[model samples]
Target: MKRRLLTLVVALTVAGYPSAAVAGDPLSRMTLAEKVGQMVVSYVYGESATSVSAADAAANEAMFGAGVTTGAQAVEKYHLGGVIYFTWSRNLTNPPQIAALSNGLQRAAMADTGIPLQISTDQEGGTVNRIGAPLAISPGAMAIGATFDPRTAYDAAKVSGTELRALGITVTHAPVVDVNTNPRNAADGVRAFSDRTAHVATFGVAAERGYRAAGVGTTAKHFPGLGDTTVNTDNGVAVTDETREQILRTHVPPFRAIIAAGAGSIMAAHIVAPSLDPTGVPASLSRPIITGLLREKLGFDGVVVTDALEAAALGDYTDEQVIVGAVRAGVDQLLMPRSVPGAIRILLDAVASGRLSERRIDQSVRRILRTKTGSPYVVEPPVVGTPAAVDTMNRIAARSITTLRSAALPLQDGQDVLVTGWGAGTTTNLATALGATRLYTGSPSDTVIAQAVAAAAEHDVTVVTTSNAWADPTQVELVQALLATGRPIVVVAVGTPYDLASFPAAPTFVAAYGYQPPTIAALAAVLQGRAQAPGRLPVTIDGLYPYGFRAP
Candidate 1:
């Protein structure tokens, strides 16, 4: 009779929660454990978690920090509403595998919790593309900006969403809407799609459309813009000097457009936009930026997420301080905080003590709930990564490879290439792609120069690639030394094209913009004359290359 009662209890529990749609309605019926779970945003390693049987309850304990299991455990166990996919683990090599793993994890998480997981990934492409899967192609925001068409931005989103959803990610933290007007910004760099306000607006709108079409919800990021700021939010103080007019006119357009297009979320930047809030509180924890401006003026009603609280950008503040401040600032999600269990206690205590209002928690929870089952995310995952689609992604990326300024490429056969750069990854990859049996001497030492001269004696072309001054001066000097050698040198600036301006003598230079493997391969192909130099410069190179210069 006792056994019968236990079996009946299990059956009643299953019957009580039929689906996610109805599960949310009884949110008030949940226990204390479930309510605390909803406040968490944590990180996990897919490969390491793969070793533990996902079916085991112990797997949840092992994968998550103390007390949490799967992200769904936050939902089922804690009544959590969301989880942001952090990519600190370097092994996620391609989109297909990442998609499959993420898809499986989210599916299992939702099944465990009886609530849909707000699964997200950082698919910004270029320097920030996290999923190596074929579905989520790595096309940076810059490429979309260069296209200057909402359709291009939309198509990239659609493709990205198709891949993300297949892997079971319903949310994508992307379309970095920061207007990068500051030439010296250390963080945004190429992460921004454009500096032009209207152009950015167009791209953001299209991106929202594409993600929606692909059945994935979009999040417009780095609110209040990090583009013109001179500070790095992760480890340094940051402030944007844009006037109120400039802020509203230039930086806010993209956010407004994407929001209007029904983007489900907006990620507040860690940088300080003092015009919006002069206390120097970073936008991520500012009431004016989050509630006053984003919610009131621009009329954004979706979830407001903070950039990773783990970023050194917030400085001196304790984790508890940051979490409480973000919630108070009207942020709906606290992204990737260092401690989930600790944060939950902090938020709950704050609410119990009246430091945070219960009404406020309800507001954020409603937005999060609306987003997970949002209209844009009506479907689970969209079909993406067809052979043709993959081909299209590659082609778009190849076409977006800005050359800055260069003489004809693919050095005539037998050209002696002089290559110098930090990190073995960039230099060796370029050599293999160009197929040049060239001499590689990394240092400017007397012995190294002597060897390089000897190697180049038999070759007609020299190819040199290096990080711009943004890295080290030695790299620039090395390129100058090669130029002094009077070899037919071709210089490629992997970081920023501006580094070449300091060059003693500008040889035929090509700006590949970034050092991703595919970008390097495409660049080498252009140098070997195997591929056409079809991409034009997306930004100015000052003295070395003009802003709009391109070579055929």
Candidate 2:
């Protein structure tokens, strides 16, 4: 068997196909089964038996049996081309453990087909980060935008890429280039850079360059844009009303700029743009958008990856249909497919039956192999979470704090200050860091509101943290009730700038963009006058503030 495999490898190399394996060209030697296997990216729980959820642990055991644990078994069985890691997928306790997991997965792939696997994760910073604690926290994209410095955006990506590279992760699904024109957009709140095309293009390209400099491949995501939709495609379908001209002008520029900067991949959004595709197909499965627009018009030759196949935006499409449609639409890789084994079988059957052409399969497989081959692979683990990483995060956070309204910094030494709001952990952190006199943890309830009001009466000033107050009526009412107290209050919008629109009467309002520890600490620094809040608004909120607004 070894001799036959070697002969096939030699023949493929002679045929001019570049093999990703160190020994020889695996693709040239692969059977249709092996080739189809390379197109599907799957997931596995990397948490230990004791760490994973009860249901997940049981399901994993059922699938792989008693001794077979981790994603290694699945990689060997399917000869997978890539594996995407979530927070639960690995022991993120330290850098060494993550390296071990990545090395183990690659070993499994090499043993099966002499091919290395593309290890990927969503390291978009802020709330979307998959690698938990100890990794340097960033203030996310919007905060970077608020600073109005492309260098800060570049440095943030560079630091994140360095950390991810140390963890043996090769691809970061990041630098969301969506120009956030809609303040109410749920899925892309602070993930986007700005509502202005120039800012998005400028900062987004800088971020891509940073990732490339660190030897990490970057993905410019949600092609055709998800910025105008109020719905979260993860839970339901989202439709965009922008005309083709509008999309080309606002949403498409950032993607075009990043692609021109040599982004390795682009993730197609699941949202439907009826104006762009009159057929109403989701961008993930639309041939015109993926092939006609992105490939032919924009001339992007990089790999096209579909967003999570399980997203509700697909809307009742069978797993078979989703898999086949995406492939037909020019997607090179199917991310987080519902069933890996089922998808492989369907693709194999499609190829055999002429439903999907072998040439088409070859097109995507080649792109996948090319990306994996060029990825930065570390043989020896490197040190991560260094002091320098923390310092960079601190500098970014300090610069990103935007004070849109204020009546002389409310936080002062030895003053009676109360910190309260929805995200209990963030509120507590801010309160601790600022040395507030009291901390009030409450939900958006009348009882909670009344308690907050009572607590405010005793404090010299109240600092309230809000998360999406514009969308939640309860939060709106809570702020209204607090405003009625006649106590001097400072409102901190931790998630989105739109929250300020709901409480226009707020005496002082600051947009932190996200609640990452660095961001919270920065907010504390600004309030205490230890640091300057120079960040400007990245989006316009009606009845509140316009883009580029910053307090004097």
Best of the candidates, TM-score: 2
Residue 364 in candidate 2, Cα distance off native in Å: 0.6
lDDT of 2 by residue, 191-254 (tens): 9999999999999999999998888888898898989999989999999998899999999999
Candidate 1 per-residue C-alpha lDDT over 147-262 given as tens digits, one digit per residue, 9 for 90 to 100: 44457677777877777776557778887888878656687767777666776777778778888897887778888888887777777767787887899888888888887778
* TM-score attained by model 1: 0.84
In angstroms, the error of model 1 at 294 is 1.1
> Number of backbone collisions per candidate, in order?
32, 0
How far out, in Å, is residue 272 in model 1? 1.8
